[model samples]
Target: MHEGATLGRRFTTLRAEPHDVPGVDRWVALDARRDVEVTVDILTSLAPGAVRQAAVRAAQVRDARFARVLASGRENVGSDRVTYVVTERPHGVRASDLIHERVVPPRVAGAIVGEAARALQVAAGQGIHHGFLRARAITVADGGRVVVSGLDAEGELATQAGLGRGRTEQADAAALAHLYLALVTGMESEQVTVPDLPDALSLGAANLARAAIAGTGPDTLAQVAAAMGPPDPAALRGLRGSLPSLPAVAHEEPQEPHAPIAVSPETLAAAEHQTELSIAAAVAAPGVAAEVAAERIVAPELEPGAAVDRSLYASPEEAAQFSRRTRKAVERERDQPLALDTFEEINEEQNAGDDRSVVQATLEFAQRHLPRNAPLDAAVERAQDRAGRSGPLSTGPLLVGLFATALLIVGLVAFNMLVSPVPMDGLSTREPDYPAYTFSPAPLPSASPSATNTE
Candidate 1:
């Protein structure tokens, strides 16, 4: 792990675009009601010798006093270092100011002015900062602990590190946070412990990503990573395969079988006996009988293809004596049925019929003609009702009977009310022991309504 890599990227939200003119500028803007604004001065510096842009990121962390050193003949330096002017003043130079100040010579040609414009745009939009030039160790976290068991110094493990640094591990600060998130969520206590580095990356993060770009093929770096843990780095390989243990393996030689197979004599005898019994039963028992019985059950349902027309037996003694006389008469005609042809003609006529209602009605009547034992009882009940209706006691008499019933019910209720609940305390009451009275016919008064109506 690189010492600086332990640090992660950090930032303040961008506020406003930076402008070319620089001396002191408002770094960030805010809505007074919603957001509180803070002002801080920014200064930028390159690594020893570097170029300066048109606008420094307002939020760049530096000396707070601007400083930079730009190589003059940088084109001549391809991976080669060169000497150039160094200055601490940001407002000291502007491309526009530089353009008018003195540039009569083409040898001191400038980088495209558009590049400077882009720099200004970045300052305004993205809020450029010192960290963008070189990854700075801005991110901070407590380095919890370091536990190393396998690998050692000299870039070695329990085995050894490659002759050179095997690989450069690339990871973002978000990736570090994501890893801890997974570990915490999945309850993963195990972690990788790598060599101490800067940026506050703990052993957990230090060894999290370690691979080699220096090597030609994966053999060296891959072997180191392979030795470190499982062979593949899912995030690196651009795949997601399980880091689970390899399928189980049996390295030992398989045992050879003995010449004579060993078995219990009784077990063998039992198996042989069962097999013999099954075979004997199959050979002797009637398997075909069940099949024959099923065939017999199906026999009554089909007509024989070679059967003579049934009319041939008509008027024969058997036909005269046949139990169903109607069918006998049907069979007697010389114009007897040619069944298959007759059925086809009948079907065609039925299909062509225009009177669909009559067809439906005939089918309904045919269905109803079938006798039902359940309905016999219902028929008897209907007959009883008809008999009752036909009798001399007609609807008028029924009304009279109903009126009489109502009067009887009212009389019973009135008599019950007049009787006392506490009569003789329910036990002391004794009826007068006397002969029951027979009423003599007393004539209703001649002036009553019945008598007057008769008159």
Candidate 2:
């Protein structure tokens, strides 16, 4: 096993110098260069974003498409769970009447990274754009816990195990399970598409999360806690519990190497079945997980011809605003799927280069090179079918019944509203086609005959 491979895999490299308070600026390496990098300074900022609850709701679906996309791909499983690192600092005040201190709900300036990840489409063996994450994993050089101080230190304090090995990997199974359940909706058991989850997840963090939330229900904190643990080499082995154990320390090992992404047609098609299902599910329920699943977000109500890639905008705020114009108000259209084939094409240009490729780069290639003129409605329908089968598993039959009832009601209403009294007049038209013609006799010859006397 190599050194720091586990922990380092989740992040790109960061070059840092100590700020007076130890922060980062003028990064030489960053997670992505192709897509706009948003610097979120946590000072009680609020931007438009997806709600965490909706994301959790999507995660709950028991489907296969979701599984294939999440599991088949190399996930950011090594990193800590997605965090909403909130800190309160004084920005300019919105001074309302001081006397009535309104207890306003907390303004969420912090964006949920997991949601951001959905647009990134990080997965196993996908090529990257020339991208790097300028990340610094600081630990005490003297065998003590290193304070992860850079930029927003308070934000650092709020996030994932903060550089300690926590058991987050076990939830990969559960996450993968949800991934698949979101895919194969309406199949029989063989085709039912269940993501294989290890029967016994030894990861301590998951166990703790489960213990914490078991009574209340499946909360995000419990779920995040669940993911804390080891990496499995056989992450793609379809059978349940087939994942082989890798050393926990190996996660941080930079030396240990694995197979690189192969750039070939057959290689691209290797996970086709799995990927197809996952994509179908993603387009259907493109929740916050879209980043991890590597789906481009489709803005709401975009015309079929418009670009729907989530990667286009720098932040969710930009996306939200673009969706709000009278000419433009619509949810983001996840554009990466439209570009998947492009990833298959020029991937060799990006293959096997850690320094050059960012996940966004690979997706950008998809956006740039993949055929954009797809039959948009058809793809959506296909994804919708899969998503419905995978998700809202119970609501379908009810909706069908409701539709039938609605039709009946509509028919009855039309019969009543269309009623009118009969008119007494038989017909309101008269014939005007025939015209009379008169014939004149030869009366002019009689006048001339009078001159000829009594002949």
> How far off is residue 7 in model 1, in Å?
30
Q: Candidate 1, 173: how far from true, in Å?
A: 8.2
Please write out the lDDT profile of model 1 over residues 355-415, one tens digit for every residue: 3344445444554574333233234323433433323223798899999999999999999
Model 2 per-residue lDDT at 293: 57
TM-score of 2: 0.16
- In candidate 2 the C-alpha lDDT for residue 201 amounts to 33
Candidate 2's C-alpha runs over 4 A off are 1-138, 141-145, 148-412, 415-419, 422-455
Candidate with the greatest TM-score versus the true structure: 2
lDDT values for all models? 0.29, 0.29
- lDDT by residue for model 2 (1-455), tens: 11122212322324322221122122222224332221221111111011121222323333321211110011132442121211111111211111022211111000111211221223111321101111121111122111111211322222221332122223222332222221112111123221322233334433432442333222332243234322221322221121122111112337868789766433333334345447666676556446535653333678879875544334545434433542242223433345566655465454423342344444445544643323332233234333333221256899999999999999998897789655659766787877788778666545566677876
lDDT score of model 2? 0.29
lDDT value, candidate 1, whole model: 0.29
